[model samples]
Target chain A: MKASYTRLAAVLLMALASVALAADNDNHQVTVTVNDINELAVTGGDITLIISSATAGQNPNQATDNTCGLEWTVNTTNKKITVATNQSSFAHTLKVQAASVSGGTAAAEVTISDTAQDLVTGVATTLGTCTLNYRATATAAQGTQSVAHTITFTITAAS
Target chain B: MKRILPTLAATAAIFLSSLGQAADVAILNGDVSLTITTAAAGQQPPAVTDETGQLEWTTLVTDAVKKIIAQTNLAGPSYTLSVRAVNISAGDGTGAGAVVLSTTPADLVVDIPSGIQPLDPGTCTLRYAASATVTGGAGTDNHSVTFTITDQ
Candidate 1:
């Protein structure tokens, strides 16, 4: 009887130790990754610039529109925005300048063509906004004809 | 001799049963990682999700109801992280909806019925979602997510 009591005590002690080691909680690692994000958009929709009348002796008064704006969100450093138009040849010359620029340096007014031109430079990791000023010029010699331009803005790595 | 043998056998059975009643829980799968890489222009980064992690638990306490709560170690994260329990099996437990994880403990699974025997573990799938915005910028948040099973 005494031996049985000893064995029982030993078993109970072992079981209690096992219970003490049992874990009621567990954990795992979770990594939330945010990759480099560069997002650009054109807001305020389509704009129209009509050159109705021109001052005497000079080219048609340049028609300008500042209704549209460009907004961008870049999470990477050393990025720039480029602008280009679809039409290689057009009747009127179109120029674009980034005005009231934030988070980047506005480039000089660029005469838009088929080749992409830098619209904004020195853009780092930040949210930026700029007003797009478009100017259209036409000489009286060029006949009056409607020309539609499909402009594209892109955010690319700075060279 | 017969009487002594029966007494030892009964004692052994009780000890084994007591050992099996201990509370335990574990994450069966490995850690979960989610990456966000795409978003519309001028919009917040799209939410990313991962469903590869799972939770397994065993509790034999028959006197009270049990539940699972979750928490994260990240205190001030620029982004948002949420988790939910789904596809529960082998137990009577209701999964909670998506709970945005933080330093505070939140209910992840509730109403876990007790009397779950050993070798018959309860399991549930873990779904995690992470989101960020352009204003949040780009960074990585390593969260040590903990799941605890306790009596409700």
Candidate 2:
């Protein structure tokens, strides 16, 4: 009877051990890869700026348009937006300024030329927007000539 | 002596039965991968999701209910990652909704009925979603997600 009792106790201990080991767990890996994203878009349709009239004895009135805006989404750091024109020389001057900026500092009004000029500065990882204020100025000595300029905007690493 | 022999046989049978009914859990699917590479201008990055992973579990504990919990190894990630159980098999377990993944264990599936004979396993599909904002920048987060079956 004593041997039987001892065997029963051992069996009960083994059963308890199995119960303790019952809880199970498993694992799997999850890899998330995020790529650098920089997206820029131009809102509104094509705009036409015309300098048609001026006050007496003054240069032709400047034609200004704020109907268009620039929007960008950047996920990296130390970036800025630059603007350039395809025309190297023209009779009239075209200037652009970034106003009502949301995510970056607006540079001074830039005279559009072949060389790229900074339009927005201190743009880092953020979503930003600004109104593209365009102004066209002509003098009486330069005469009246319609100049169609193709402007390009680029986002690049800040200097 | 005859009564002692019968008692030992009954005890041995009971122990063997308990040993055969141990709870177990396993992942049926392999590692999951997700990516976030696009977003609209002037907006945050869109969330991405993957639903190819699955989980299978078994339990026979009659006294207590069982649940499946999930946890990750990454802490202080720049982006947000969330998970949920979906397309659950017709069993005793119910799918839990989306839960943001973190180091602390959170319930992914709950109300698992126990005492299942023949060790019928409950299974469910796993869905993982990852998202980021423009300010969060870009990076990768590798997480070793663990799933455990424990008494509730």
Candidate 3:
């Protein structure tokens, strides 16, 4: 009877050890998630495209060097920068052209309308500076009423 | 003596049966953990100085995988998971240093809870894409994402 009891105790101890080992093997997995980021910045807000007193002979009143200028610095992380005007038509025709860019290429003289325009289109990952120039065409009817238009800039991922 | 021996054998059998019951009663509590991952690694969008310049971060559901893994030992109880932004730094531009984080399937509220079945404890996983946008000053913007889990 004593020998039988010793065998039973050993079996119970082994069972308990196995259960503890199994519990130790169980794991609860966790994962941390963050997504890709692409950010952009532009210096100088509310650009004043001042086209001084115009003469009809001038046709298109071009802005002086410091008169109508804006600079944009963007980190286009594998994306392109698109430009557009808020409305299809304004009191006066507004034209925007990139004078120079620190990196990549810029659009030639493009008239702003409802449609979107491409300012910078490439996969560049550095802060790029782009110089912009604005021009306006005023008619005798549409005098110096000080018309204002909102220009929108958009960034899109590369295909 | 012979009758006493039979009684001893019967007592031992009863003790062994009790041990078996104790083993069957072993229970493990369920738990869950969540993590946010990105494919772009360390690259972050440039800081904005004005509204015209916008910063955008996008990820496919497969790439971001807002992962949530949960396990349970008992049936009938469900686990709820939710996430949100904790802090945002300052910026001069409009909506600058602001974080607009959103999940696809638009789970603005609590998501579907992980359900456990009878006689079986199991684990469940959920994945989704996250997108964020901010516009503001040219500085290091700070923010955090919070994840919470509850049982119901």
TM-score of chain B of each: 0.83, 0.82, 0.21
Off by over 4 Å in 1: A1-22, A43-52, A66-68, A85-92, A99-108, A113-118, A121-131, A140-150, A157-159, B1-20, B88-91, B118-120
lDDT of 1 by residue, A12-107 (tens): 677667767677899999999899899899999998889988778777888999999998888778899999999988888899999999879999
Off by over 4 Å in 2: A1-23, B1-21, B61-63, B116-120
Q: What tens-digit string does per-residue lDDT give for candidate 1 at B1-152?
A: 74876577677757665665656778977888999997776556779999999988777766377889999999998789999999988455888889999999999998888766557778889999999876677789999999998887
What's candidate 1's DockQ score?
0.36
Give lDDT: candidate 3, residue A121.
64
Pairs clashing in candidate 2? Answer: none
Indicate the residue-level lDDT of A100 in model 1. 97
Per-residue lDDT of model 3, residues A28-141, tens digit only: 222222233344454455666666765656554655332333333333345666678877656777777665665446767777787877776663644455666766676666
On residues B1-152, what C-alpha lDDT tens digit does candidate 3 reach at each position? 55555465566656554443211111123222232222121233321211111111111222222222123222221112222211211210111122223222222112212222123422222222222221121222122222222211
Docking category of candidate 3: incorrect
Clashing pairs in 1: none
